[model samples]
Target: MNVFVSLLRTGVPALGGWLVALAARHGLHIDGDAVAGVLTPTAVFLYYTVFRFAEEHVSPRFGWLLGYARPPEYKALPA
Candidate 1:
């Protein structure tokens, strides 16, 4: 389950980035490395935003789908 979750978290962004890069290369006539340079950070930013949102708003069971582990509740914290 963890492995699946991990893959989902990484694979989607990777594939999206690749597609974006490809589109930039072919459709926009951008260079390969330049397209990657632009899209890489964009993809990372998007992934971080999505996962953080999920961690805050979604159930812990589903939060793993975005690669977040829920923090312990207040009752579980040490004094």
Candidate 2:
């Protein structure tokens, strides 16, 4: 799971930047700096949401791959 999360953390930003670069190459009128400012935060939000969801819902075995001992649960704690 850690591996998956790590990959997402890195890959999302890289993919966003790559897309921005590709757009620039194709003569898109977008401002690279402005796009980067937007893309980076969006990627971060996506990565965080995915990671949190996986941590809560994925099987323990797969979670272990990401160094999670177990999937998170919503049960209430002892009073």
Candidate 3:
């Protein structure tokens, strides 16, 4: 699933956006494409950057917030 759909499915994270979109539709009015084109990348970058910092400085447990229940172990290939 794309980030927008995933965020919606996950709940809370996308709620604000949906609320804004609803308001904009009935009141302000903006193109859906305009919002989606900018929002997806911004959200992806912001979420990853913030959560990655938290995982490094605060606690590894924060990894779950990024969808990893357990951090993946890095393994080097055998030569």
| Model 3, C-alpha of 57: deviation from truth (Å) | 0.4
1-79 in candidate 3: lDDT tens per residue? 3554344434432443455445445553567777665665556566666766888889988766666533455557899
Higher-scoring candidate on lDDT, 1 or 2: 1
Candidate 1 per-residue lDDT over residues 33-52, each given as its tens digit: 88788877687667656765
What TM-score would each prediction reach against the true structure?
Answer: 0.47, 0.41, 0.57
Tell me the spans in candidate 1 whose CA falls farther than 4 Å from its real position: 1-28, 66-68, 71-79
Sort by TM-score, top down from the best = 3, 1, 2
| CA-only RMSD, every prediction | 5.5, 7.3, 6.6
- The predicted structure with the larger TM-score, 1 or 2, is 1
- Superposed Cα deviation of residue 41, candidate 1 (Å): 1.3
Best by TM-score: 3
lDDT on C-alpha atoms for all candidate structures = 0.62, 0.55, 0.57
lDDT (Cα, 0-100) at 31 in candidate 3: 78
TM-score of 1: 0.47
